[model samples]
Target: MEENAIRNKYQELGVEGFYTQYGADYSNPHEAQIRQLLLQNQDRIDYNKVLDFCCGSGEVSRTLIEAGYGHVFASDPFTYEAYQKNCGRECWQYTFEDVIRTPIPEQFSAVICSFAMHLCPDEQLFPLVYQLFQSTSQLVIITPHKRPELEQLEGVQLAFEDFCLTAKGKQVRLKAYTSTFTY
Candidate 1:
């Protein structure tokens, strides 16, 4: 992905403005189907202090809240006012660099990132994943499972055990592995 294009798009429209101008109505049937799928698995995942990284419009954040998760944090570098207004919450404006530089406030029970990690350039891969592991007690990364382009990326294939066996030995467990595809 071209970082400049992404940044420029956000700059031109901001998060909410862009979505309003270009986004499809989630009220459509296909989105309803996706929401049903999400709800089906919502019960299986841990949600304590969940962080929705790169949460563009906080759709999944609202889902987590509706599924009964409390203390959820949503973030993106761009201003997602549409999402914030929809969810009745504010978003933290921070880039992945900022996320890595600052200490994560809580050992999150679940960290959710969808279509977010792939945006990090190749050089930022390891460091970003390391920080991701550090921030979350459980990681639920949702990316295109069949993206051959990303097949060799370590972040996509990283085992939960690898992060669990740290010097701190925080006694982490590989709770689950999940993925999806976009049509």
Candidate 2:
């Protein structure tokens, strides 16, 4: 889809609605930048166990796996088929709301939410993040927008950040955070 068309669709249906309807076909246009950012900072992630939250099409999982991070799990309420097909692994069907209601059962070294965290509504962000922190010490959010700014949350701290630019000069950022609350 064209950029403007995607934007219009998002405006028309809202983020969750749009994704619920089209997530199986969703593809990140900034995938190259996402790959670049992850490959450049792969060392920062713990390969022990990582959850690719909101793993649309398994972009982050695929990148991390290729980088030799063996224990990569993925979850996306809407993109299970795409994620499984792309990454060749089972994708947990957990939505952000689900996580907020019940934290993930397994602990992870880190949870990577790529391209989709910013879409979370403001009211739900804190609880969702708090729940995520319950499952992992590290939370890595990769976004093209600055809305999430997870560091603003009381217990969350931005430990490191880096960015990669697209051909049109848009900045895609990788923000790694840690919270005072331990799992």
Candidate 3:
């Protein structure tokens, strides 16, 4: 499958291994920091029916739930097992192949794609993005700045970046871009 090819490529590279090696906190940026950023903008966004796309181990979903976001749907092409191991939340709707092949059946309050877009190959990037965009009114992306993967997408806008400083004081920019998607 297409997702498996990407997964295998990630495994060959160090992306998946690094994520698995250091767990959630060491994945360049942690998810809780993004949650704090989203919480600050909570007045504008609905906290219900959120989709955590490319949800590696559901760390971000757990963080969102802790921050009072209800109905968080965690989806990934390869990490739901890890998610079950990590948080074990009872929402039973996603599988490894769901994100790529299965269409998003309905609009969500917001769709959150963190760190995954950069991993997507050029051929798959736009359609995946369009699918995400078509499935939600707002798409929140927390990605590295200067991601060429997103350079040419037609239907999204940059909202604001929350540059998080680690304990070591290193700057990790979570570029939270937004867009209104209507089907």
Off by over 4 Å in 2: none
In terms of TM-score, which candidate is strongest?
Answer: 2
Pull out the clashing pairs in model 1. Answer: none
Error of 2 at 46 (Å): 1.6
lDDT per residue for candidate 3 within 1-183, as digits (tens), equals 233554575678676574454433322235555666566667755658888877777756877778777688876645656766776764344432354466688778888776566766677666676676667766776653356335357766766555565455645455544555455
Q: Write the per-residue lDDT of candidate 1 for residues 95-156, one digit (tens) a residue.
A: 77876786466677677766456567667765665666676645665543222133254544
lDDT score of residue 81 within candidate 3: 65
- Candidate 3 local lDDT, residue 103: 62
Taking all chains together, the TM-score of candidate 3 against the true structure is 0.70
Could you give me the TM-score of model 1 versus the true structure? 0.62
Assess every candidate by TM-score: 0.62, 0.95, 0.70
**In model 3, which range of ten residues has the least summed lDDT?**
20-29
- Tens digits of per-residue lDDT for model 2, 71-104: 9999998889988888889999998889989999
